[model samples]
Target chain A: MNQTIIQEVRETTPLIHHLTNQVVMNFSANGLLSFGAAPVMAKAEEETAEMAANANGLLLNIGTLTSQELPAMINAGKTANERGIPVVLDPVGVAATPFRTNAVKRILSDVQPTIIKGNAGELAHLVEIPWETKGVESVGDGNADEIALKVAETYQSAAIVTGKTDVICIGSEVVHNHTGHPILGKITGAGCLLGSILTACLTTNKSIEQQALTAVQFYGLAAEYAAERPDVNGPGTFLSHFIDALAYDPAKLERE
Target chain B: MNQTIIQEVRETTPLIHHLTNQVVMNFSANGLLSFGAAPVMAKAEEETAEMAANANGLLLNIGTLTSQELPAMINAGKTANERGIPVVLDPVGVAATPFRTNAVKRILSDVQPTIIKGNAGELAHLVEIPWETKGVESVGDGNADEIALKVAETYQSAAIVTGKTDVICIGSEVVHNHTGHPILGKITGAGCLLGSILTACLTTNKSIEQQALTAVQFYGLAAEYAAERPDVNGPGTFLSHFIDALAYDPAKLERE
Candidate 1:
C-alpha cells in the first residue's frame, strides 16, 4: 500500500460519524483524531441520520449494542448509503448471542455496508460458518482469508479479517498484513479503533481493497512501534504510545 | 487526606460495575483496572441489578444517555442502594439537554447515589442553578466549593466537583484538592474515568468525603507524573504514561 494515503488522511481530516458500541467510543474517537481524522459520535436516533449525511464516512459497530442504538445504527447506515459516503461495519461478537446475530443480519440486508471488518470468528459467523466465540473475542481456528473472501463476495463489499495476519479481500483479490503485535489483543477497543481508522481511510478516493489493506497495515505497524517503546511495559502504557504512533510521520514509519 | 486509602484500594481490587456513557466505558474500565480495581460494565436491564448486587461499588454516568439506558441505570442504582453498595453518579452533560437532565433527576430521586460527581456546571444544573454548558464540558465559572456543598447538603451524600482544583463536600465539611492539570480538560473521559476511580475508592472502608478526596488527589498526582515523562509531549503520550502512573507505587508518588 502507498504510504501517501496516510498523508492524505492528515491533509483532509475527514469527518467520520460513528454509531459504535458503548465500550470503545472514547478510544475510537481519540484514535481517529490521532490519525488526523475528525470523529463525531451521535447516537440519539433524532440526530444520527443528519450526522451521517454530514460526515465523509460512517462506521457501525455492535460491540455493546442496546435495543435503542440498533435503530440509530440502521438509520445512520442507510443515510450514509443514500449520501454515497462509505459505511464500514464491524460485526463485533455477532456469534455471542442471537440478538447480535439477528442485528448483523438485519444491518447487512438493509444498510449494505461498503466494507465489513471483523476477526476470523466474527467474519465466519456472518457467513454462517460455524465458529466458537467467547463474548467479543474470536477463539475459533479457520482459514481467515477464505472467510474474508467469501464474506466480501456475499456482501459485494470489501472484507477485512484481522488477527496475527490481517486479511483483506475485495472480490477475489486478497492481501495479508503481518505488521501488528500480540499486545494489541490485550487492550480493549484495539479492534474497534481499527474499525474507526478504516472508516477514516475509506473517506479517501481509493479502492475499497486498498483502503482496507492500508488501514490494517498502518494500525498493525503502529502497534508494533508502541510495543517496542521502553515506556510501554504493559497494556496501560501501550495505549498512550500507540496513540502517539498513530500521529507519527507516515514516511518515517514506512522507512522503519 | 490519608494516603493509606490508595493502598487499601490496591489491596482490595474492588469490582466496580459501571453504567456509564458510550464514549468513556473502555477508558473507565482500563483506568479502574490500572488502579487495582476490577471493572465490570453491564447495561442490559435484565442483568444490571444482579451485576450491581455483586459489585463492590456502582458508577452511573449519563454522558451519552439513551432512552433505553435510563431504566437500566435506575434499576442498577436502586439495586446498589438496596445492597448498601456505594453508588457514585457522574451527571455528565445534564445541563446540555433536557433528556439528560430528566434522567439524572429520576435517578437522584429513585437511586439516591452515595456520592455525586460532576463539574461545577453539572452540579449547578442539579440544583437548578443556571450555568452555561457546551456539550459535556463545563464552561461557566462559579464557586465550585459552594455548589458542591449545596449538592451534598441537599442529597445528604458526598459531592465532588472536579476541575483545575478538585472540591469534595459532605455535610458541613469541605476539602479542596489542587492536584490536577490543565491537560486533563483536553482529553475525553478524563472526568468519567475519575468517576470510576472514585467508585473503586468508595469500596474501601473510609468516610465518603475522604474517599472522594483521595481518588481525586491520586488521579491528579498520576496526571502530574505522566506529564513529567520524557515521551509525554502531548495528550496522546500523556494518556499512556498516566495509566502507568495509576499502577505506580503510592510511596514513590508521595516522594515525587
Candidate 2:
C-alpha cells in the first residue's frame, strides 16, 4: 500500500496549498516539489480561499501564525473544507503558549481537518488531556500511543505524533510506527514537510490508513537515504540530500 | 561612503528580522548570509516583537502575505520602530490587486517604512497614482527613473525601482542607476532578495544613502557574474549561481 501511494505521488503530482509559518515556508515548498507535488504558499485572505478551493489538498500550519495569517488560514481552511479537499492541520507549538492554543482551537472550530499532526504534547493538549511537552519536542508521561488514539477519536481526525519514531492513530487502532532518522530532528521543517507529503498522499489515495503508512515509510526512507550520503555535514548537508532523496526515483527505493 | 558601508556590512553582520512571504524566504536568508548578515525569519507574534527588537533591521515583504502574518508584521514593525531599527518594505503586487494594495497601505500607515522598494507600477499604485502592471512586471507611460524618484518623494522614503536598469532614489535625487542583466527576472525572488540585501546594508551603515548604493551595486555585480557562468541552464541554475556569486569574494566585482 505504501509503495502504491508513492507510485501515485510520482504519477499524479498534486498541487498542495500551504498556509504555513514564515520560517518553514521555503523548506516546505521545496520539500513538496521534491515529492512530485507543486506547492503554493498563499496567505492573503482574499486569494487564499481561491487558492485553497483550487488545490488538490490544503495543509494549514500555524508554526508562524500571526494576526493576519490566522484569518487567512480560517478562510482558506473553510474554503478547502467546503470544496471537499483534504485539509491537514499542523498545530505547531500549540502547547507552548496560550496564543498558539487559541489559534489551534479557532482553526479546529472553522475547519474539520482530515488529519492533525503535531508532537505528543500538542496533541494531548488539543484533546484536553494532561501530557508532557518540552519546547515543541515530545517528552511526556502517560501513554503517548493511547493519548494519540484518544485525540484522533475526539477530533474525528487522524492524529500523528512525530519524534524518534512517528505514531499515527485513529480511534483505538494504532496505525503505524515509522522509524525515521535521528538527523531529521536536526533539520528544521522536517515535521512541516511531513504534513505536506501527507497532503500529497491524501490527494492520490482515499484510505487514511494507506496514506498515513505510505507517507511515514516514504519520508523515513528518504531520510535513511540522506543519512547514507558521503560526508553528511550535519543538518545543512542533510537538508540538501533529503530533498534530493525525495526527488529520487521510486524505483531506487525498491532496489534498496 | 558606499565603501564604508560595505566594510561595515562585512564587519557587523547585523541580524535582520524578516516577516516576509514564503516564496523567497530561502533566497532572502541565503542572500543576507552571503552579504555577511544574519537573517532571522520570525513571523510568530509570540516571538516576532522579540526578534525585531533584538535585530538591527526589519524587512516586511508582502509577496505571500497571509492573514496570520499581518499581525506578526505589525508586532515586529512596531517593536523595530520603538527600538530605532531600520525597516524596509517591499510592496510586491501592490498595484495588481485590492488585497495587496490595502495590505500595503495598512503596513505603510502602521510601520512608516525607512525604504519602499518595488517596480514602477507597484510604486505608482502605492502613491495612489494609476499605472499599468503585468504580473510583477511593469511597463507604463512614465520613465522608470522618474517613477522611482516620484515614488521616493511621495513616500518620504528611499524608493528603488529595478528593471532593465536599477534606479534608486532618495526623494527626487535618482541617486544610483545600476545597469543589470535582464536574465535576473527569469528567476523568482530576485526582488525579494534585493530587499534582504538592502536591509543588511542599512543595518550596517550609518545612513540609508550609502547603504542603498552599496546594496544595488553589490546585487547588480552578483547578477552580472551569475549571468556570465557558462552552465547557466535555466532559472534553477541561475538561482544556484546567484547564491554562489553572493558568497564569492568581494574582489570578484572589480570588473563590473
Candidate 3:
C-alpha cells in the first residue's frame, strides 16, 4: 500500500484538535504523537471555536458524551468546516443510550463532518441498521460495507467502518482493507486512536478516500506488528508496543 | 513492603468509582484493571451519587477539571463519604488554571475526601504553599513531606504527595517510599493509576496511611520493574510493560 501518505503525515506533523471522549484522551494524544502528529485537546465550550480554528484537523468523538460538551463539539466542527480543514466524527456507542443517539443526531444536523468513523454497530446506528451493542462495545455487524456506503451517502461525508474487514467509502467509492490484529479488540482506545490518526491523515494533501484508507491500513498494520512481538504477552504489553509501532518503520516493527 | 495487599485486591476485586479527568481515563481504567481492581467511571451528576454509593471506593481526580463536572465530583465524594467507603481525591494540576483550582476548592468545601493525592506543587496549591509549576506537570519541590502533613491536617484526609521521593501522610504520621523509576515520569497517568490502585488499597481494613504508603511503594516498584525490561526502550514500551508489571508477581516483574 502507498506509504508516501505516512511520510507526508510525518513531514507535515498536522495538529489535530480533539473534543473527544474522556476515556481515550491520553492514549489518543500519545498515539497521535507517536504517529508524528501533534494533538491538542480543548473541550471547553468557550474555546472550541478558537481551538478548532487553529487546528489542522478536528476530531469529535462522543464515547462518553456529556450534555455540556455537545454545543462545544458543534461549534468546533463548524469552525473546522469554515476553515476547510477535515472534521472526523466518531459516533462512539450511539446505540448504547438515547442520550448518545440524540446527541449524535443533533451534531449531524448542525455540522458537516469530512469523515465519520466508527465500528459496525456504531456506524450502523447512524444509518438505522439493526445491530447489537453492550455499553460502548460494538461486536454486531450490519453488513459493514453497506453501512459504510449508507452512512457516507446519508451524511454526505466519508465513512470508515471498522471491524474484521474494515470498509471505507466516499461518494459511491468503497475501499476494503484487511490489515488489523485482534489484539486491538483487547485494548480500550484502539478505535479512538484510529479516529485520532485518521484525523492526522486527513490533514495531508492526499485525497480524502485514500487518506482514510491509508490511516486504517497503517493502524491495522501497527497493531499486527505490535501484537506479534515475542515479549508482547497480552493486551497490556500489546498497547505499549502498538504505540511504539506507530513510530517504528514497518520494516523494523517486528524484531521478535 | 507487605505484598498481601495485592492479594487482597485480587481477591476482593473492589470496584473503584472514578470522576477523573478526560486525559487519563482509559489508561487509568486499564491500569486499575491490570492491578486487579474493577474501575467504574461515571461522571454525570445524574449517576455519580448512585455509582459512588455502590462502589467499594471513589476516586475524584481533577486532572482536567471542567465546570460542568465539578458538581458531579462533589456529589460522588459526598456519597462515598456517607457510605463509609474510601474516597481518593487526586487534585491534578490544581495550580495550572483557576478553573481547576476553584473547582477543587469547591469540591473540598462540599465533600470530605478520605485521601487527597497530588504532586508536591498541586498539594501545595491547596495549602497556599508557593511552588512553581508549568501547566499540569509539577517539577518544583516545596517540601513534599511538609505539604503532605499540612494537607492531611487541613482537609482531615490522608495526603499522598508524589515527587522524586513519594510521601504519604495522615494525622501527623508520614511514610516515605523510594522505589520507582524515572521512566514513570515519562508517561502520563502514573500518578492517576496510583490514585486508582491506592483507592483499592484503601478499601481494605488497613489504616488509611498504611494503605496509601503501600500503594505508592507497589506502584514505584512496578515502574522500576517495567522500565528495567530489556525490550522496553522508551516511554511507549515502558507503559505496556508497566501495565504487565502491575499484574505480574513482584518476584516475576523483571526477568529480562
Candidate 4:
C-alpha cells in the first residue's frame, strides 16, 4: 500500500456521512477528524439521503441496530451508490442477534456497498461460515484471508476481516496487516474507526485493494504507536494517544 | 457536596440505561464505567422499557434527535419513572433547532426526569430564556445558578447547568462548582458524559441537590486532573487522560 494514500486523505479532508451505531459514532468521527477527514453523522430518514449525496463517502455500521434506522441506512446507501461515492459497510455484531443478521442481508441486497468490513466472527456470519461469537467480539479463530476473499467474492465488494491479523481482499488479491496491539481491542470502536478510515481512503482514486490495504495498515500503525507510549499504561490512556498518533505524520513510524 | 458520594458510586456499580444521541454514546458509556458504573445503551423501542426497568438509572439525551428514537426515549423514561429509578435528561442542542427544542419539551412533559442536565444555553432554552447557542455549544453568557434554579423549580427536579462554573440547583437551593477546564468544551460530549455520571450518582441515597453537586464537582475535578498531565497537549490527549482521571482516586489529586 502506498503511504501517499494517508497524505491524500489529509489533503482532501473528504466529507464522510456516517449512518453508524450509537456505540462508536463519536469515536469514529473523532478518529476520522484526526486522520484529516470530515465526518457528518445523519441518521434521520429525512436527511440521510441528502447528506450522503453531498458527502465524498458514506460509512454504514450496524453495531446498535434499531428497527427504525434500517430504512435510513438503506436510503443513505442507495444515495451513495447513485453518486458513485464509495460506501463502506461495517457489519458489527452480525452474529449477536437475528435482527442484525437480517439487517446486514437487507443492506447487502439493497445498497451493494463498495467495501464490507467486519471482524472474523461477523464475516463468518456474513458468509454463513460457522464461528463462535460472544456478543460483538469474535471468540473463535478462522482463516481471515480466506474469509475476506470469500466474502469479497460472494458479495462482489472489497472485504476486510480484521483480527490479530487484519485481512484485506479485493477480487483475487489479498493482503495482511499485523501492526496492531492487544490494547486496541480493550477499547470500543477500534474497528468502527477503521471503517471511517477506509471511507476516507476510498474517496481517493486508488484501487479498491490498495484502499483497503492502506486503511488497515495505517490504523494498525497508529494503534502500535499509541500502545508504545510511556503514558499509555492501559486502554483508557491508549484511546487518547491513539487519536494523537492518527494525527501524527505516518512517515515518522517505522516501516516494514 | 460530600466527597463520600464518589465512594458510594464505586460501591454500587449502578447499571445505567442510556437513550442518548449517537454522537456521545461510547464516551458516555466509557466515562460511566471509569466512574465504576455499569452502562447499558438500549434505544430500540421494543427493548428500552425493559432495559430501563432493569437499570438503576436512565439517561435521555437529544443531541442527535431522530424521529425514530423519540418513542424509545419516552418509553424508557416512563419505565424508569415507574421503577422509581432516577432519570437524568440532557437537553443537548435544544436551542439549535426547533425539532430538538420540541423534543426536549415532549420529554420534559412526559418523562418527569429526576434531574435535568445541560449547559447554560440548553437550560435557558428549556425555560424560554433567550440565549445564543452555536449548535450544541453555548456561546451566550447567563447566570447559570439562576437558570438552574428556575428550571428545577418549574420541573420539580434537580437541575445541573454546566459551564465555566457548574451550577447545581434543587428547588430554591443553588450551589456552584468551580473545577472544570476550558478543554472540556473542546470535546463533543463533555456535557453528555456528565449526564451519565449524574445518573450514576443519583442512584445513591443522597439528596437530589447533593447528587447533582457531587457529580458536577467530581467530573470537573477529573477534567482538571486530565488537563494537568504532561502527555496531554490538547483535546485528543485530554480525552484519554480524562478517562484515566475518572478512574483515579480524588484524594490523590492536589487539593485546592
Candidate 5:
C-alpha cells in the first residue's frame, strides 16, 4: 500500500472540481468527502472555467452528457491543464451513442487530460480498438492489456481500465489491481466514485501512476471490507458500508 | 400503514420516468428500485416526451437544473398529464437562486403536477408564503400547515412539506407523518427518494391521498428500521440499510 499517497490525500483534503454526469454527483461528492477530500460540483458554463482554475483537481465525466455541457467541460479541462493541475476524464458510456462519443471527442481534442479512466469497453472505443460493449457494462473477453496499452499510447495519458482485475497503464509501464469485490458491479457509480477520488489522489506531488495505483488499491480494499460485513447482505448494504469504509481510518483497515 | 399501496407498487412494478437533478439520480433510481418501482432517467429534450408519455408516472426535480432542461421537463410533464399519469414535482432548492426558482415556476405553469413535493421553504415559495430559508435546509418556524395548504390550493395539486415532520396536504385535509429518523436529515436525497417512490405509489387504483400516505408511511418506517439497525452507525450506513429496508418484506419489518 502506498500509505504516503493516502496520507497525503487525507492531510491535504484537496478540492476536486467536478463537471461529472448527473447520475453520480451525490455519490461522487459523498465518496470524495468520505475519502477526506473536498468536492465542488459545478457544471454551469458561466463558472466552470473559473472553478477549474482554482481547484486542485478537475474531473470531467460523460455518463449523462448533453450537448449543452460540452463547452463548459472543455473550458474547465483547458483551465485545469493551463494550471498544471491533474485532470481526470471518465468517458462513461462513450460507445453507447454517437452523441456521447462525439462529446468525448470534443473534450479530448481541446484538453490534455492527465489521467483517463474508464472500463475496458469504453477505453477500447477511445483507442478505436475492437471490444464488445453493451451500454458501458462489459469489457468482454478481449485483450484488455492491449486495450489499456493502446489507450495509454493513444491518449498520451495514464489509462485505468476497471473490471474484474483493474488494469492501469501509463506509457510503457502497467500495473494490475486485484483487490476488489464483485458487489461494486451491482451498484452504480463505483467507477465514478473512483474517478473522483483518483482526481484528488493525483493532486498529491506523488507520481500519477503511483497515486492512481494507491487510490485503486485503497478503494478496492475498502470494498472488500464493506462487502465482508455480516450485515452487508446485498448491493444496498454493501453500498452503505463502502462509504463508511472510505471514511475508515486506513491504519485500522487490517484484514482478519 | 396502507399495505395495499406497497402490494400494488410491488405487483405492477410501475415504470417511473424521472427528469430529476443530477445530485440524486443514482440514489433515487436505486431507492425506487428497492421500493419495487422501475426508474428511467431521461432528460434529453428529444426523448423526454416519449419516455414520460409511456411511463406509469413522471418525476420532475430541479435540484441541479440547467437552462436546457426546463423545456424537456415541461414537455415530459405535459406528456404525463396528457396520458393522465401522475406527475410528481420536487422543486428542490428553489429558493437558492433565480434560475432554479424560475425553472420550477415555468414547469408549474405548463404542467399540472398531481403532487407537488418540497421542503417547507420550497413549497412556501411556490404558494407565495413567507418562510425563512437558506439553500434548501430550514422550514424555520413558519406556518408549515398554511404553506402546505396554500400550495395545495394554489396549484390545485396535493402538496407535501417535508422537514422534521412531513406534512401532506390534499385540498382541505392535511396529514403529518411521524415515522422517520433524524439520520434522514443527514443524507442528501432522502426527500428526492421519497418523491420517486411517491410517484410509483400514486399509480395505484386507490385515491391519491391514500397512496401518498402509504408511501410516506412506508418510507419513514424504512428509515426508522434502517436507523435502528445494530450495525448502522451513521448516515453512510443508514443510507445502505435504508435501501435494503426499502426492499425488505413488510411482514418481516416489525420491531421486536
Candidate 6:
C-alpha cells in the first residue's frame, strides 16, 4: 500500500494548500516540497478561498489559531469542499484551549474533512471525551489503536492517531503497527509534515484506505530512516536529514 | 571587522524578534539559529510589542507583507525603538507596491531604524526617488554604492545595499566591492537571511559597521561555497547545502 501510494504521489505531485500555525508553516511547506508536492500558503482572508480552490488538497491546522485567521480557514475549507478537494484537519492542541477546540469544531462543520489527523488526546477530545493534553503533547487514556478506531467511527472520516506507532482507521478497518522513532518529537513540525504528506497521498491514491495507511506507515518509516544515522544527533540535524531522505529516497513508499 | 563580528555573534547569540514576510521567515529563523541566536517571530498584533521589547534586536521586512501584517510591523518597530533594541529594516519590495512603500514610510517615520538594508532601487524608493524596480528583483542604478551611502547619511542609519557586489555604509565611512555568488538569487530568502544574519552580528559586534560587513560577507561566502557544488541542481538542494555549510563552516566570516 505504501509503495503504491508513493508511486502515485511521485507521479501526481499535487499542490496542497495549508492554513496552519506559524511554527510549522515553513517546515510543512519544505516537507511537501521535499516530497515533490507544491505548497501554497496563502493565509490572508482575501485570497485563501482562491488558493484553496486551485490546490489539490487543503490542510487546516489550529495549533496557534487567532481570531483573525478563523474566518479565512472557514472560507478556504468551504472553497475546498465546493471544489471536491480533499481536506485534512490537523486538530493540534484541540484539548488545550477553548478557542482551538471551538475553531476545530467550526472548521470540521464547515469543511466535511476527508481526514482528521491528531494525537490520542486530541482525537479523544474531538469526539467529546475527557483527555490529557500535556502542553501540545498527548497522554492517552488507553491504547492509541482502539482510540483511533473509535474516533474514526465517530467522525465518519479517516482518523490517523500518530505516536510511537501510527494507527490509521477508515470506519472499522484499522491499519495498526507503524514503526517510527522517538527522535521525531524533538523535531518541530513532524506531525504537521505528516499531515502534509497525508494530503499528498490522498490526492494521488484513489483508495481512501490505501491513502491513510500508506501515509502513516511511510511517514514513520521516513522518521526511522532519518533517526538511524549516528550524525543525526539532535532534532535540527534529524529534520534536515529526514527531509533530504524523503526528497531523494527512490523507495520512499517501500516499507523496509 | 568580519572576525570581530563573528566572534561577538557566536558569543552573544542574541534573541532576535522578526516581523518579516512568510517567504523568508523559516530561512531567516534557521540562519539565526545556526549562528547561535534565538529567533522569536511574534507577528500577531497582540504580542508584537512584548516580543519586540524582550528581544535584543528587531528585524522588519516588507517583502511579502499583506495588508494585515503592516500594523504588527509598526507595533513591533515602535516597541523596539522604545526599548533601544537595534531595529534593522529590510525594505524589500518597497518599490513594488504602494502599500509596501507606504508601510515602510510609516514605520521609518515613527521608529528610528538602526540599519536600513535593501538593493539600490528599494533604498532609492525608501528615500522617495524615481528608482526602477524590475518586479521584486532590483539590480539598482550603476551608482548603487553611492546611493546607499547617501541614503544612510540622509536617514542617519547604517545602510546596506547588496547584489553581485555588496555595500555597507556607516555615516561617512563606507565599504564597497565585497564578493558573493551569482547563484544566490536562484534561492529565495537570501536577502531576508542576510537581515537575520546581521541581527545575529549586532548582538556581538558592538559597531554597526562590523555587523553589516560581516553578515553580508559570511552569507556571500556560504552561497559561493554552495555554488561550487555541481550537485546543487536547484533551489531545494542549494538551500539544504547552504544550511549545511553554515553549520559546518569554521571560517564563515574570513576576509578575502
TM-score: which candidate is best?
Answer: 5
- The digit string of per-residue lDDT tens for model 1 on A1-256 reads 6577778898887888888876778888788877888776757775578667778899999988877678889988998999999999999999889999999988988898989999999999888888888888998888998999899999999899988998888889988999899999899999999999998888888777678888888898888888888767999888877887888876656666
Question: If you assessed candidate 2 against the hidden native complex, which CAPRI class would it receive?
Answer: incorrect
Q: What lDDT score is found at residue B106 in candidate 3? A: 91
**What are the iRMS values of all candidates?**
3.7, 5.2, 3.5, 3.5, 3.8, 5.6
* Candidate 1 per-residue C-alpha lDDT over B1-256 given as tens digits, one digit per residue, 9 for 90 to 100: 5677878989989999999877777778888898899999988989999999999999998876777778899999899999999999998867755666677889988988888989999999988777876545677898998898889889988899888888888888888999888767646688889999899888888887678888888889898888887778557888867888899876666677
Global fold similarity of model 5 (TM-score): 0.68
Please list the residue runs of candidate 2 whose C-alpha ends up more than 4 Å from where it truly belongs after superposition.
Answer: A1-13, A44-47, A66-69, A141-144, A170-173, A253-256, B1-26, B32-61, B66-98, B101-191, B194-242, B249-256
Fraction of reference contacts reproduced per prediction?
0.30, 0.27, 0.29, 0.30, 0.26, 0.01
For candidate 4, write residues A18-58 as lDDT tens digits.
99877887788889999999999978999999999999999
Q: Which ten residues in a row have the lowest lDDT in candidate 5 chain A?
A: A132-141
Q: In model 6, which regions exceed 4 Å deviation?
A: A1-17, A21-58, A62-68, A74-191, A198-220, A223-256, B1-15, B26-42, B54-56, B96-99, B128-133, B140-146, B233-237, B252-256
Error of 3 at B164 (Å): 11
Residue-level lDDT tens digits of model 2 in A6-107: 778778777788888777877777677667776767667787787777678999988878876688899889988899999999998899889999998999
User: What is every candidate's alpha-carbon RMSD to the true fold?
Assistant: 6.3, 7.4, 6.3, 6.4, 6.2, 6.9
Q: Is the docking of candidate 4 incorrect, acceptable, medium or high quality?
A: incorrect
lDDT of 6 by residue, A176-247 (tens): 755678766544567888999899888974688888877777677778888776665445456777887677
Model 5, residue B80: what's the lDDT? 90
lDDT for B184 (candidate 5): 91
* Model 4 lDDT at residue A137: 62
